[model samples]
Target: MSKLNIDQKKIKQLFEDKRSDFLIPDYQRPYAWGEDECQTLWKDIFNFAFPDKELEKFNSDEEYFLGPIVTFENNKKLEVIDGQQRLTTLMLLLRVFYKRLEKMKDENSMRTKQNLAQCIWKSDEFGNENKEKLKIDSQVALDEHKNEFLEILKTGDAKDFKSQYAINFRYFEKEVDEFLKEYPSYFAYLPTRILNNCILLPIEADNEKTALRIFSTLNDRGKPLADADIFKAQFYKFYVAKNQKDEFIEKWKNLEILCKEVFSKKDNTSTDEIFNRYMYYQRALKGNKNSTTEGLRDFYEKDSYALLKSDRTFEDLQNLGSFWQAISIQDKNYFDENTLRWLFILNYAPNIMWANITSVYFMKNRDEQNQLDNIKFAKFLEKITAFIFAYSFIYPSVSQLRIPIYSAMIDIINDKEMDFSKFLFEKENLKTFIQN
Candidate 1:
C-alpha cells in the first residue's frame, strides 16, 4: 500500500524551485484549453486578485483555489497524471506575465519578473535563471508539441496561433494588455496576485499504479477515458522498469500516429481500435472461445493488466498497426489486389468480428518482409467474408456468431489447416441464409 502525499500550495510555491520539474507523459491528451476556458480562468483570477477594492493592498488571507494536479515521482521528475491542462495553461499565463514585465524596469516589475522566472525555469543559487531548463515538459505525441511549448515560453510569442499553447498564450497577452490599458497603476500587482493567491492541491502518489487508480477514480463521473490510455500507462510502467522508457515512448508515438491515420473512429480512438482488434487475437491464442467478449478496458485490465506487461503484446500490436495501415491505404507493396478487395467487402459486413478474426490471422502469419502471404490471405478473406455474411443472416443476433468466429480465430492462431466447412451453416440453414 503506497502512501499519497497531499499538499495544497500556491501556484508560485508549486513551481518556484528546481525541484518542481513536471512531465506530462506521452499518453495524455495535448493542451486543449480554448478561449472560453482561458476567459473563465482569467475572469475568476482577476476578480479574486483585485476584489473590487482600492488597489493599494489586498486582504492577505484571500486565496483562489485552482483545483488539483495529480502526479507521481519518476526518475526525479513529477510525472503528471492529471491536471495537465490547467498546469499548462498556468505556465502559459505566467510566461505571458514574465514577458510583459520585461519591458518595465520598476522595482515591483523586476521583482515580479524574477518570481515568474523561478516558476518557469531552473534558477541558480545566484538567482540567475537557466533558460534551457523549463520547469515543465509535456511529452504528448503531436509533432513538435513539446518544442512548441518550449519555444513559446522561451520567446515572448508564437506566429503559429494554431496550437493551443500559442492560442492561450496570445489570449493571455491580449487580456494583460487590455488590463494594462484599463488599470495602468494596478498592472504590476496582477502577477503578484496570481502567483501568491492562486492555489492548487497537489496529489502526489508513491507509484504509477496508485496515481492511475486515483486518476480513473477521479474521472469516473467527469469525462470518459479511452481504454488505450490505461493500457498505455501499464506499458509505460513496464518499459520504465526495464529502463527502456525512451524506446517505448517513440514506439507509442508512432503507434498513435499510425492508428489515427489508418483506423476508423466512431467513439473510440484509432489506438483503441487496434487494441480492440488485438483483444480478439489474444482471446484466440488463449482458446477461450466460449467466453463472451468483454469491454475493451475490462479485457486488457484482467489480472492486474497482465496482458500489457509482455513485450510480445506490444510487438504484436505494432505489427497489427502496420497491417491495418496497409489495409487502410491499400499498400500494394504489401497486400495484393484480391486481398484488398475481400477486405473491402469485409469492411461492409454488419459486424466487426470478421476484421477482428482477420487481425488474429495476420499476426500469426505476417512475414518478416512485412508482406502477407497474398494467396493465402486472399483465400482466407474470401472464405471469412462468406462465412460471416452467412452466419449473420442465419443467426441475426451478433452474439450468435462469436463462438464460431472465436474457434476459427483459435485455429488461425495455431497455424492449423483451417476447415472452413466447420464454420459453415448446415445445408438447410445455408439455403435459408442465401434465400434471405
Candidate 2:
C-alpha cells in the first residue's frame, strides 16, 4: 500500500479480493440507514436492471454508478473514510444472493456461489475459518452483531435476528425474493451484474486531512460544512500548527470518546443538545439574546477560530469535558441528592443559561471544598432553578432571564468573597433571574 491509492472499481472488483481488507473506523457513527434508504436503493437497482419491461432481458455487464468512497490504504487495509453506508448495505445484498445460489447446489450454481462468496469473505488456507473482507469495526456493536451478521452471510438463515443490520438484510431478502419470482433466472444473473456493474469511485488519499478535504469538497455541496466535523478538523490543524499533534490527538480523541458515551441519544442527551445547553449559558453570560433562541453554530463559527487562542480553547474544552462527564448522569461519587436537585433544574430550565453559568462556576471551583460542598451547592442551584422555572412560566420567555443571571454569576465568580446571595440581591430583576 502506497501513501495514496485512488481507484475507480466496480463493487465486485472492490470486495472480491483477498489482497486487502476494508474497515470502517471505530470512531465513525454506527450503521444508521433504515427502511426508507434501503427501499430507495432497492428501487434504483430494480429499475436499472429492468428499465421498462418486467424481466424481459438482462445486461449483467452494464454498470450503474453508485457514488464516491473516501479511504486511506495502510498495510494493504483500506480504511473507509466515507460511503460505508452503501458498501455495508450492498454487502448484505451480496450475502443474500450467495445464499440463494448455494441452495440450488448445481455444479454451475456451486461455481457462481463460490465466486460471489469471494466478494464477501476470504477463507483461510486450511479452510477452517473465513474473514469478512469489509469490516464495520465498531468494537462493541461488531463484537455483539458480527457472529450473527456473518452467520447470515454464510448460511442465509434469518433466525432470532432483529438488529437494524439484520432487519435490513431481511427486508432486502424479501424484495429480492419477490423480484426473483418474476425472473427466476435473475438469481444466477445478479452475482454477475453486482460484481461487474455496480460501480464506485474509491479515492484513496495520503492522510486523514487530505481525505477529509476531499470529502468536504464533494459532500459539502449538499450539507454545509460548518458543523462539528469541520470544527474538529480545525482543531486538528491547530495542533499540527503548534507541533503538538500527538498530544492534541490523544486528548481530543479521549474527549470525543467520552462525549460520545455521555451524550449519546441513548443517554437522552444528544451531542448537539449538550453543546447547545452550554452555548445557551455562554451567550446568556455575554448578554447575547440569541443564546436562548439560536444554536451554537451561530456563535461558534468555524471562521471564528481567531476569536479565542487555540490552546485556551483546547483547555476550556478539556475542562468542560471533565466536568460534563461527572455531572452528566447520576454517579454516586459525583451526584448527591442535592446534585440531583441541580440536574432537575437543568432539565426544568427553559434557556439552560443557568446550567452553562453554574457549570462554569463548578469548573472553576472543582478542587475548592469550602465553596463546592454538594449540600450547599445544591441549595444554591435549587434557588436558581426554582426562580427561572417560575419566571419562564409567568413570562413564557427564557431569553429575557439569560442576561441577568449571567451577569450575577460573573460578579459572584469574580468577587473574592464569592457571595451568591449578595450578588443576587444587588442584581436588578433578582426575582426573575435568581431569587425564589
Candidate 3:
C-alpha cells in the first residue's frame, strides 16, 4: 500500500538495467502467447522498424508501446504479477536475435549482440556479460517448461520441446531468419529498432498482495485469464505448502481435461463453467440462496480465498466435474435412460436454473456404483422439470424461479424431502396454459 513506483522505459533501458532482474512468481499463470501473438508483435515491430518511406527515414521519436508490466520487489528481484506473456516472448525474441547475431562477423551485428547480451543476461561488476544466468525466470511454469525455457536461452536449442516457450522461440527464430534472408541489409537494423524503440511501462508495487489485486483487475494483451486460473494458483499454493503439490497438479490437470471435453464454451471456459456450477453447490451448503450471487472470483476470493484453501472444496469440485462430465457424455454407468430422458427435457428448459439443483441432488444422492439413485433421481428430475416448465409459464420473468430453485437446492443439499406445496402448482391453469 505504499506509494507506487511507475516508470516508462524503452526495451534497451528496461533490459540493460542491472537492477531489474525479473521472476515470474509461482502463482502467476504460465506464458500463454501463441504463434498469433508472436506474429502480430513481429509485424508491428517490422512495420515500425521499416516504414514505407525507408529504414533511414524511420523516426527516432516514434515508439511502439508494448504495454505495462506489473511487479513487486522480492529479494531485489521483481516478481511479475502481470505481463509475463509479453515479457517472456520479448526475451525469446531477443535471444533469437542474439543467436543469429552471434554467427555474424560484422561490427553492427556484434555490437547489437553485446547490447542484447546485457539485456538477456546479467553483467559482472566489471560490465562483462554473465552468460551463466538469464535476466528472467518462470517459477510459475511446469518443471519441464522452466527447464526448456532456460535451456533455449542458454543453448538456443529447442529440440523436441513443444511448450509455448519453445514454440514461440522457434517461431521468432524462423521469422528472424526469413527477415534476414529477405532484407539482408535491413536485418541488423531490426533488433536495434526493437531494442531501442519499443516501450514498456513498469508499475512496481510495494507488496505482493497489492500487485496481485492489480493483476486481477488488469486485462492482458490477450483475454484476461479465467477465474479458475486464479483459483488454480491458490490451490497450488495450498498444496505446495503441504508438500502435496504433485498430487494436486495431477488431479487438477485431469479435472481440466474432463471439463474441457464435457462443458460447452457458450457461456464460459469449461473450467470456469464447472467452477460456476460448484460455486452454486457451495452457496447451497451455506444456505445462501436468496441474495444475488457473487461473481465467481469474488465468491472464492472472499475471506482470503477460504474456499480454495480447503482440500474438501477441491475434492467436491472434482466430484462435481466428474458428475457433469458423465451427464454430458451420457455415460451409461452414471444414469439410467429414464433419468437422462428427464435431464434431456430440462436441458432444453428456458433457463439453466435446473442445473445446480440437479448438481446438489446428485452430490447428496449419487451411489457407490458410480450411478445416481435412479428411482429417486428420476422422480426428482421429473418433479424439477415440471416445476421449471410450470413456473416458466406462470411467471413473468425467469428471475422469479431463482429463489424457489435455490431453496430446492438447499433442501437437496440438506437431504430434506421435496414438497412443492409452497409453490402455486395451479393444475387447471397449468393444463390450460400447456394446451395453449
Candidate 4:
C-alpha cells in the first residue's frame, strides 16, 4: 500500500476530473444529511479557512476541521468508501457558488463562474449538460442518492424532504433564488474556497477485505453506534471467546421450541404467530400501564429463564429454578412446562382486575412461612394460571373479562368451602358472566 498526500486542491481535482470514476453503487443507502448537519458543515468550513480577521469578533481559538474523504479501489475506479456527506455538501456549495456568480455582471465574476462551472459541470460524450441534470436523470438513481439535496432546497427547511425528488427540487430552486438576494458575495467565494481548501485522507490497502476492515474501523470511531450494532459486535466476541458458533446457532434454532411445545397442545393457532401475538400483547399491556413498552420484548426474547442453562449464576438461577420447582410440585402432571403461569395471568388480566386478585390472594395467604414454601406458592400460581386461561378461552372476544374472573378467583380463595370445581369445571355461570 502506498501513502498519498492529499489536500483540498488535490481532492477537488480528483472529484472534478473523475466524475464517472467515483460512483456510489446501487447497494449504498441514500444520503441522510438534514439541514442542521449541512448548516453545521457550512459554518465549520467558513469559520476554519476564513477565520475572522477582527480580533474582537474572534471569540474562541478552537479550529474548525472537516472529516476525511474515504475512497476504495475498484480496479482502476476509486469508490467512495465514506465521506459521501462531505462530498455531497461540497457539491451543493459549488452549485450555490455558481448561482451567485451568474447573478454578477462583472468580468471577475464571469471568470470565477467559468472556473467553478468547469470543475463540477463539464459536458460528457452524450452532451449531458450539468451535474444537476445528470443527478436527477433517473428516478431510481435520484431516489437512492440526490433526493436529500433537492429536499433541503424545496422546503427551505431540512426536515421536509419526503421520498420524492421532483417535490424537493422545486424547493431547491426556490431556496437558491431566495439565498442569492441576501449573501451574494459570500455565496460566490465561500463555496469555491471550501472546495479548494478542505483536506482528504485516502486510506489504501492491498485488498478489498483489508479495505473493508479499515472502513469498519473508521465508521466505528466516528459515529454514535446503535445498540444493535454493539450487540452484533458482542455476539461475534461471544462466538469467538467460546469457540461455539454452532452452539449459539443451535440455541437460536431452539428459541421457538418452547413456544411450539406449549401452544401445540391447543392446536388452534400457529405457535410462531401466537408467540409474536403474545409479545405484542405484553407490549400493549406495558404501554397501557406505563405508557411505554421498554424492555418487555427484551425480557421475552433474551432475558427469559429457560434459555440460560447452567451458565446462569447461582443466585439468579436459584430463583428461576425455585419458580419451576414450585410449578412442578403444584401441578405434578406437567414437569417440563416453560410457561410462566403467574406472569401470563397478570399479563392477560386487566390491570385493575389483576391487582384486585393479587390483593385478595396475598391477603389470604399472608403467612411468611407458607409464602416461602415452593409447593404452597406453586399451588397459588397454578390457580391464578388456570383462572386466567379459563376466562380468556371462555370469553375470547370480551375486552374486560378479567373483572369477573378476578372476583370469582378471590371468592374461591377466601371461602374454603366454595369449591374451585364449581367455578372452573361448571363453566356455564362463569362463561355467562365473562361473556356479559
Candidate 5:
C-alpha cells in the first residue's frame, strides 16, 4: 500500500482534458465482457445518478467511487495497467449520452455535445490530424478487434460489428432510450453527476513495474473479481513486498501461463468450471457438503486466502490445473497405464457420475505419485466406475436404485474410514455397488 502516487479525481475530469490518451498494453487481455457485466454496470450507474426518490439526497460535490485506474505517463499517452474494462465501459456510456444529446435539439445541445467530445477524443489540430486517443494496443491476433472497438465508438452502430464492445454499445443505447421515456430530465442531472460527483481514482506510477505492483495491491472494491485475477495481483505484490528472488516470480508466472493455455482451448473451461471441480474434490475428501460456485468462492477468499498465499500454493494450483486439463482434453499422461485404461472404460460407460469422481481424485493426488497413492487411487477409481456400470446394468433406473446409489456415494465421500466392500457388489451376477 505504501508504494503509490494516488489521485482522487472525477470521471468527467478525466475526459474533459483534450490531452488524455490511454494506451492499453499488448500483454493485456482483450475486452471479454458480455451482457452480464454490461447489465450490472448499467444498473449501478442508473441507481446512483437516476435521482430516484429512494436514492439518498446528496449534493453535487458528493462523489460516488467508480473504482481505481492504475497507470503511468509515457510521453503524451497514459499507459494503462488496470481498470481498462471499467474505463472502456464508461466510455461507451458517455457515447450513448452524446448521441442522445445530438438528437434532442435543446438550447444546451451544442454545449453538452462539446463537453462529451472532450471526454471521448482530443480535437484534431491542423498539424496533427490523426492522433489516437484511448489506444488498445493488443497482440496482433486481437488487433482487429481493437480496431472494431474504435469504429463502434465513433459511429455508435451495432451493424457489421460483433465484439462484446459492439453488443454493449447497442445495449447502452437502448437502456438510455428507455430511461428518457419515463424521466426525460434524468440526463440533465446525469451529465453533471458523472462529471462532478462520479469518482475515478487515477494512480500514476513512475514505470510499468510500479504500476503493476500498485495494481496487484488494489482491493478493487465494487468491481467484479475472478479468483485467478485477484490471486495474481496479490501474489505479485507478495513477490515484490517480501523481496522474493526472480526465481519464485518466474515459477509463479509459469503457473499463470499454464492456466491460460489450458483455459483457452475450450469455451466451457473457465475459472468456474475448474475451480468447481477443485472445490468438489477438496470438500468431498473432507466429507463436507458445500459444492456450489458461491460456496467455493466464499471459501477461497475467506478461509483459504489467508492460508494459501505463498509460492507453494501457486505450484499446487498449477498442478491442479494440469489434472483438470488431462481429464478435459482426454490426455491421461498423469495417470499410469492401468488407471488410464480404467478411465477409458469410464469414459465409454454411458454416464458421467464416476468420471466426475475420478477427476476429483486426480486433482487431490496430483502430486502424490508413489506406489501406495497410485494403488489407492486406482482401486478407488475402479470401485466407483464398476459400481456405476453394474448398478445401471442390474437395476431398471433411478426408480429401483436411485436412493441407494446416491446415498452410497455420499457416505463413501464423507466417511473415508467406512468399509468399501460392504456397499459395493449388490447383485449376484455382476459387481454392482448398490442394492440389487
Candidate 6:
C-alpha cells in the first residue's frame, strides 16, 4: 500500500538496469492490449510530461495514470504483479532511444543509452554457477520481449501516438535522420531526457492473489464488466476452493457443448445469451405462467424449447417427449422437429390445453381416439395455434400480452359445454384478436 516515488529518470534507469530481475510467468495471459490501449497510455505519459498545452481531454484521470506496479517477493526474485503493458511499452521506447543515441555519436547520449540498457537488460551475477538463473539470455525470453516491443511499433497508429504524446517517434526518427545529414547536434540529446514521467504506484502484496484482485478492481468504475469476466472470477473462486480447476473447466466445457448442440439449429441466436436467457426465464416462471422481463433478455436471445434436446437426464428427456406428444395431437401433419421444439413454450403456461385434449380422448375410450374424433379438439387447437402463430410470427414482441392471450385460451378450453370447433370458426373472435 506504500507509494514508492520512482520518477521518470529512475523509471528509465530501473528498466535499463533491473529489467532482468523481473520475470513474467507463463501463467499470466499473453499481452493482449491492442493499439488503442497502448496509444492511450502513451497519451497519458505525454500529458503528464507536458501538461501546459490544452491537449485533448482524456476520459478520466485513471485513464491518464497507469494503475500500479505490484512488486512480489518470490523465493528470491521480484515479480511484476501488474502494469506489464506500460512496462513493456516503455522498454520499446528505450530501444528506440538507444538506436537513436548510437546514430548520433554523442558521448552524453551514449552514456544515457548505456545506463538505460543496463537497467532493462542487465542481471546481477550472484555466482558463476547461478548466472543463468538471474541473466536475461534465454532465447524464449528474448523473443517474447522483442516481440512485445515490435508489436507496439507495428500496431500503434502515428496520429494516436503522436498527437496524444506530442511527439511521434517515426516522425522524430525521420526528422533526426534529415537533421543529422546537416546539423548532427540533434542526436547529442536523448528524447528520454525531454519526456518527464512518474512510476505507477507500487503495491507490495502476495503476487498471484494480489494480481487477480488488482486487475479485477482496476477498471471497476469504467464501463460495466462483461458477464464472461464475472463468470471467470466466480469459476476461479469455486475452482481454487475445491482444488478442482480442471473439473470446473470441464463442466464449463460440457455446458458449452450442451448449449451449442441445442441452440445452434435456431436462427440468428447467440448460445451464451440464450443459455443466460433460458436460466432467467425458468427463474421468472417458477412453475407459474407469470414472469417479468427484467432478466428475460437472456432466454429470449435463444430458442428455449430447442435447448431441451441437450438434457440427457431421464426426467428432462421425458418432459421433452411429453411436450412433443401434446404437439403431435394438436397438429399431426405439422408435427416436425421444429414445430415440436416450439411446443416447450406451452410448458410455461398454467393450463396444458393440448395435454388436456389428449387426456380427455384417452379417458373416453381405452383405444386412442381416431384423428377424425379428435376433430372436436380442432377448434381448441386452432385458437392455440392462431395465438402462437400471432405471437411468434405477427407480433413477435415479448411482453405482458403473452400471459393474457394464454389465459384467455385456457378459459375457452375449460368451458365444458363449449365446442372448440364452433368457437374457432366464429368470425367475430378471430377478427377481434387479429385487429387487437
Best by lDDT: 1
Could you give candidate 3's per-residue lDDT for residues 259-363 as a string of tens digits? 888876743367888888888888888899775777888788899998889988898888888888878877777779898898778879888778878877877
After superposing candidate 4 on the true structure, give the runs of residues whose Cα lies further than 4 Å from its correct spot: 1-11, 53-65, 122-187, 204-207, 223-436
Q: Write the per-residue lDDT of candidate 2 for residues 82-184, one digit (tens) a residue.
A: 7877877887888788777766866766776776766777657653236443333332211236556656665667658877778889998898788778767
Give candidate 2 misplaced runs (Cα > 4 Å): 1-4, 54-61, 74-76, 105-108, 123-147, 221-361, 366-436
Local distance difference test scores for all models: 0.84, 0.64, 0.83, 0.45, 0.62, 0.42
Ranking by lDDT: 1, 3, 2, 5, 4, 6
Q: How close is candidate 2 to the true structure, as a TM-score?
A: 0.55
Tens digits of lDDT, candidate 4, 65-154? 466655555655555655665666555565555655666887767766766655555456654445443221111121333556544432
- Residues 1-436, candidate 6: write the lDDT tens digits: 5323333234643443343366553333234455566556555565554354223332223222345655565655556545655555555455455556654455777666555545445444631122123222111121233343333343332433322222334544454455346535544332443222444455555544455456557645532222333333344344556676565555544544444454343432222343343342243234334434343333322453233323232223233333334453545563444444445445454433334333332222223322223344444445555554444433345453445443443333344342333323345755666687
Clashing residue pairs in candidate 3, if any?
none
User: Number of the top candidate by TM-score?
Assistant: 3
Off by over 4 Å in 1: 51-60, 105-107, 125-128, 155-164, 220-268, 282-355, 365-408, 417-436
- True-structure lDDT of candidate 6: 0.42
Please report the TM-score between candidate 5 and the true structure: 0.52
TM values, all candidates: 0.68, 0.55, 0.83, 0.41, 0.52, 0.40
lDDT of 1 by residue, 1-436 (tens): 7999998999888988567999988777667779999999999988888778457557868889998899999999999988888998999999998988898988999899999999999988997999988999876643346678888988767777567788888889899999888887767798998889889999999997688778878866554356787789789888989998888888988898898888756544678999999988888888878747787887888899998999999998998898888888878887778878898888789988888888888878877865678999899888888878877888878898887888888889888866666665587978866786
Query: What's model 3's TM-score?
Result: 0.83
True-structure RMSD, every candidate: 6.0, 10.2, 3.8, 19.0, 13.1, 13.9
Candidate 1 least-lDDT 10 residues = 138-147
